[model samples]
Target: MIVQTLPGRRAFIRENTRLQAPPHTPELSLHLADEVTPIWRLTEEALEEIGLPPPFWAFAWAGGQALARYVLDHPDIVAGRRVVDFATGSGIVAIAAMKAGARRVLATDIDVFCEAAVGLNAEANAVAVDFTDQNLLNAPPPQADVLLAGDICYERPMAEAVMAWLRRGREAGARVLIGDPGRTYFPKDGLEKLAEYQVPTTRELEDLAVKRTSVWTLP
Candidate 1:
């Protein structure tokens, strides 16, 4: 079933976020939350205020920003490939894949409001990205040549689940690429480091203003 966006959700996102270029990847513009705290503090009465899940889509996270920069600079990674940006908060990487000349891009986030957020941001960047809220864990690998994920190792269970799923995608012959800010749970054993970037982020969101982010591919 097509999940229709709730009333005022899209407008609320537009009103709450600011259109700006992320610090690390200025080649593309995105609709992003100017600050994290305000959205973080939103309450249930904030329904018409916004029914978003934690507003992860509001901020241009360091990992996503770094991955986007990599894709923009290295278009060959995704060019002419069908790609999927998993847990695509703010759709930054997905937008970059499309901008980098991917044949098609599907940005999937479990958060319901992220579809609206991704669409709005894609429009701002003049790129096309398909957004979905399906939880793809335990499902068979998607029909994609490339799979991209950023900052997915924050929580232990999620890290385990998504990493297992990503491994399946790799087993199916898709190139699995991930961007991370050195989170503790990031799997250390089987990845090839591709690039690194000093991503500027808010202290309110991350512990530091400049995070050392890296892009890696599965072995």
Candidate 2:
């Protein structure tokens, strides 16, 4: 069943799928559901409406949907855990973790703008999330119990670095979970698939080559 929205709820905003991206460029537009929304264009607008941020690098990739579906389907994974959304772009996974009952949620990103976005999105969802401008490339936070990442392994060097960090986190007994939508450099070994979901991508915002995506979980 589709998740139902609460009436006059200032908690979460839903993005309509029928909205079109702008012409002549790869930048897509979104509609915000909040009154003091921060989206500058249609792409940002849509994500603001959905309590998310416009795609940081590529709009319409829909990484948030993949993570959100996972949370809605399996709240048990995040229930009562201290979860960290590493490389949180628009705070999608972090928000989902909060919705799933994580004891505390921290959304970390290298991008400074993501901090503002996370704060705004968290306020929009009426959930508390610690948004920080820390980079996980050096190391995972020492206090993280569950490390969650989505759509982070697209580039080669970055993917390698992230995988190494994840391996270390796993060795340290932390439950490391990754939500990848078939990105180019996603690791293919030693990972048990937890779930999968079909997510939408936009040719107008990104390349037509990666129009649609499938979300996968690494155990």
Q: TM-scores of all models?
A: 0.93, 0.70
By lDDT, the best candidate is 1
lDDT of 2: 0.60
Report RMSD for candidate 1.
2.8
Candidate 2 local lDDT, residue 156:
92
Best by TM-score: 1
Span of 10 residues, lowest total lDDT, candidate 1: 1-10
Query: Mind giving the per-residue lDDT tens digits that candidate 2 earns over 1-112?
Result: 1212222111222332222331211122322222222333544432344444444622324555566567756788789988888787657678778877899988888643
Error of 1 at 16 (Å): 0.7
